[model samples]
Target: MASKAGDDPDSLMSLCTIFCLKNLRRTMCYSEGEQNRLQLRPDVFLPGEICDRLVNEYMDLVHTDSDFEPQDGFFQLFSDPRSTRLTRLQLREDLVRDRDLEAIGKQDLMELHLTYCSRLTARGLRTLCSFRHSLLSLSLFGCSSVFFRKSGAPLAAGEDEDEEERLQRHTVDLDFSFQGFNRLRLLNLGGLRAELDVEKLLRPLPALTSLDLSSVHLPRPAFLTQWSERLASLVLYNVELTEELIHMLLQMSRLRHLDISRENQRTSKFKMTRKILSSIVQSLVDLVSLDISGHIMLDNCTVPAFEDAVGRPSIEPCKSSIYPFQELKRPLQFLGLYNTTLCNVTHIPAYKVLSFEPILRLLPQSSAPVSQHWATWALYNLVSVYCEYFTVKPSHQIRFHPKIMSFSV
Candidate 1:
């Protein structure tokens, strides 16, 4: 069936406002069951079962240019207590400003996600405090301008700080408090280029579980020990990984996801050793996802000694040497090792690093030209010592080379 969106010039684009907004923060929300009887009958397609109140309550926003809703009319809508019952909203845009937050402040929202809204300042954060008591999840990634600067902010993430590396520090007087966030669980403050009081900010939220502190400075990550019993997942992308921080992370017995990927943008004083990697894999028994991308190391770091892991397959047919390692005891759903030396190593059974049959099957099945091309290369990379089981056929002819070759089903 065709969508009910009409023949208007902007037929393709439509807006929706629901109680639950899906993102990295899986916030819980409850509908208050309040209906605005004063709202005029809106012209909409036969609304679905739950659509009557949830959809029509905010549909007045559809007429954006004040053609349908006048200033007094908006005031009327705002004055009604029911209008302030919105629970979930994600307003992500460079154009979002402080005034928009002020308007939203009236509502006791449960979840709010705003990323890259650069125009927002400290005043906007003040408005956000209105929902501090009720909010369950909040993500303010890349919205650093909201903080007032003190000394220079955290350096551009490295062992050595350059003049341009300096980032602003948030002073104690930002007029914000985490004290009332009793129900808050998921918090993503990634890309906040400020020297945040890591301990003070987190000491209040006893319920916080999943946190993404990407690009944020944590000179004193001792807070990890405090939250060890509660914190479950963490993303520390581009943040410095010191030995102390590593030790603190190992204590989080409940931690499931850990992404310490450096992306090669900066330098970490600690080079990830095979020993350290093995220790992490062995200790963090509950870990479901682990990423160690871009930290420099020569030896095979992650996959330890086990037999259940599939045999390492290669595309180059060079079985001259195989770094023998056993399978990991636990199951990891995701493992990210991009931009690392392991980019070419395909022995990780946890991630199915480079299983032979999977890459071969993906070749013809991949319909897109780019996908087919990469699948062909993946096949090229899987030339095992035992090619007796598999036959190299060209869906088309190829100038095959002994060392490096092209492949087809």
Candidate 2:
């Protein structure tokens, strides 16, 4: 009796029958209450839950196996704006602990701006300095914690420490003794307000091209003068640009760009006069561009002198009598004469004037690689104003082209 086909106690169920029973139970238990608790529809939750569960279950298989390649799970999770903002602190902490993970090969990462990151302390920065070999740019713009706050203590008689110890204790002392980044191009230490020895920092960076010490309370020009050949661009914004500093810059024949704005603290006889400006420009024969804006003391004469110096020929006249006949062959290509009425067309050579106004109109029409918005605007305005002075006849087409002439300022 017990050995019957369907009612036998020892009889086994077929695979199809077992699968049908499991599906039936799953369908019956799939309710809206469960959907509501998970805040997702059953159709949506089912696939997502299955994917997450599978990933967790096979995590080792995916990570360890040479053939398996998983998607960027971290990027998928943190790409959302909410997730980015919420987890930034945690991410920073994790990055600090796993410093080696941030080393993404031999790419220059100079002037890193980690502003408002409270957890990024001096120790963290010191750790990050391991990348100094490839790091030429570093910008800790609003990192108040890394900056020095004056400690109200008098000098101790017995404590004589080394450069590394001094750097750790003092905010201004940047001890970069660990060498490797020989190709550092630009260093912007703005808002640090520390007393940094410019020479010490520059000594390590043999390939340094630009240095911005805006509001950094740096030492005298002598420190910079030591590495004049290596420094091509110098920004002393809101810092003091003394006569000595100007002379130092003039002596640096390789310097191409110099910004000495009102941010300079020293009040010296560094007038933007015709003779002084011309002399300064004349000294930098290799300069391709020069910017001296935001200094209210500069007058209209400064413009002509700048143009004359830039347009002057690299080769000096043999005698004073041959000066008038000396012609410039390579004039400065880019000159920033912003915020000054000194752009008097009469002072510049007729053939050497390249107005920006016409160039601006032509830029939109042309297919050249003019990318920067501010630079485009500046070119447009410059050409437009310069074109106003030139009387173009209806029969004659007015063209604003960059002038090519020898260095004869």
Candidate 3:
């Protein structure tokens, strides 16, 4: 049967809501002994159901609250509140009622995303542990609900300084163990200010495959080594990267994607030098995607090491003996060098490093020139220098290297 264009998923979901309401009315009719007035409520697509008032409250919070600025109007598009025990619940700058928490404990929720819900206390977080066995994905990004202290506008000078001192003193001590999240696959603990003991938070979740610790206090590097083989994707944006941490990460050979992009423009004292880059390529052989771009301490010395790692032709020695590492174990898919010293296209050395050798490895064995390995290299800082490369476009290709490379604008 040819489905009409109007029978989209959104329409189908609406239809489901209607059917649930009808079912609820019919059930109410039978229970109330044919009462003229019938109350309608939604039914669960799976097993259990949620309160109608709670759904209305969530929708009202989304539309009226400024803090709950969803990425798009499509925030709650996929999961309808009317049905589905495993649903997406987003609450911001509002109190999580005890009844709601109780309801959540009863339902078989798979995903929960709570952001900036300042009124949700530590007790509420404890209550959330009820879903430890069921929840597959959980995000507590920007949620300062556990231990938030309110402050009034400064009436006197130096009051702001006093508040800062007070805030430091009252640092929330959030130490929830993740031992219960046995089935959790993806966890985002971004913007958490409390002390996160790696042993309790990370070691327990053996099934954890992806983690986002952006802007969160990092646990000891030694603790992360436990997940070296388990974790496939890790995001550490703006997290302080010490020399010890870099050395520890070298052992995570199973990591397929790693992002350590610095948020600040000023380079840190701990530079990501050639030695560090060489050690990374040598150690993290399974890495397919890596992002060490932005204002992290990147210098000229690191360029040659990257060129060698990605198999690009460089003025620097590319011989197996000089290079610390063998050919890259995993074909490099993405390289981010935006707003860094290595972004100079006018400079031959920078251009060579930016030439991206990973694309060459992905070239088809057949003689056909059309290639599928498209690599996106971000060079936002070097507009003039990048333009200069196009002037010598043909020079980029050679008879010796049949592999072709294409870059996204």
Candidate 4:
């Protein structure tokens, strides 16, 4: 029995309800002249038809960006009769507060992302603990205000005295009561520099598989040891990879995605030699995404890997002193060498070589012009080299820059 086109869930979702502004640029809705004059108020409308479409069709209300910073504020946005069915919500760099979060708490949200919501404190976050059993993902990335005891938001002498007091109380609540996120699988605390007790934070999150501790202060590696068994994706970018951290990483047998990219200047040169690279390969058998970009390589000398892991032949780093090994079990899906040079990369393991998928993945969706520019160049080369067998994905079909196709021709 052939199902009708309307009966197909994929077809119906594509044809109706879900409205993604991601594919549609702001320029598509407003002219440059009108955009300049348009005051982007909280409750402002963007040409009646578009606004109507959003209200009528939205089922989940995923306004992921701060671009269309909800006309009626978050409260009114949730007040929509259709908003009762909402599950996932992502908001960034907004003046969203506890009162707004209270409204959001009413919904049975499964994935909540409140990135850089400076106005929000842990007091408001405690409201969403009711959804602890249901919620699977929560990213409070860059929302430093939640962790801090003080409000950085400039206020006159005696402005919102209650909220200031609340911030202090909630900061304490966050320390002990954050166990509500037990079912959470993905947690991103990137760029949050605060005095954090790493052990207490990870104690409740038993199900967490992907964690982004980028630019965070993870002094004790013992806290991360508990997560070694379940955690598959871990991003420790810009954090110091101490000797204990390296030893603990060697035990994470299930880890597939590891991003140890670091700042070139602040990070003392990490020695990434052939031996240490071999050790990583042998231990982390399931490792697929390895990002050791921007590090000081050794065995010879100078600048290297992940907040710069030191790999001196004379100095044994990890517990497994034995090296000159092979066997990945699987090829790495992505290898990030963003800031590394030929001089730095010497005796890296001869593991089947890298796939072009990483560069291909970067081209179409890259928000940065420089990334797109370099990715396009790399994509062309991959196409030229493997043009005989290369098959362009449908999503990547129209996104290729003109010069690459022209040059390839």
Which pairs clash in the backbone of model 3?
A: none
Give the candidate order by descending TM-score.
1, 4, 3, 2
Give per-residue CA lDDT, model 3, range 68-123, as digits (tens). Answer: 53222122222333543435565554443323454455555677776655445445
Estimated TM-score per prediction? Answer: 0.62, 0.48, 0.60, 0.61
For residues 101-182, write the lDDT of model 2, one tens digit per residue: 1322122333343433333344445555655765655544434334332133322210233323433454442444325667
Root-mean-square deviation (CA) per prediction: 12.0, 19.3, 11.7, 11.5
Model 3's alpha-carbon lDDT is 0.53
Worst 10 residues of 2 by lDDT: 86-95
- Model 3: how far residue 27 lies from native, Å: 14
lDDT of 1 by residue, 1-409 (tens): 6566644433432332322211101222222225422332222222222222332333434334344332222212232234235566665644455665675566667788877776666667777788888889999988765554335443112112221332333344445667888899999888766555656666788899999998789888877787788888899988888888888888888888888977453467668776677667666778877777667774654433352144644222122112222324543555555455554443343432222223444445445343332343345445543243566465533223332232222
**How far does residue 314 in candidate 1 sit from its true spot (Å)?**
12
lDDT of 1: 0.56
Report the Cα lDDT for residue 93, model 3.
Answer: 46
Off by over 4 Å in 3: 1-7, 10-61, 64-84, 87-99, 147-175, 194-199, 301-327, 344-409
Candidate 4: segments with Cα more than 4 A from true spot: 1-69, 76-83, 149-176, 300-326, 342-409
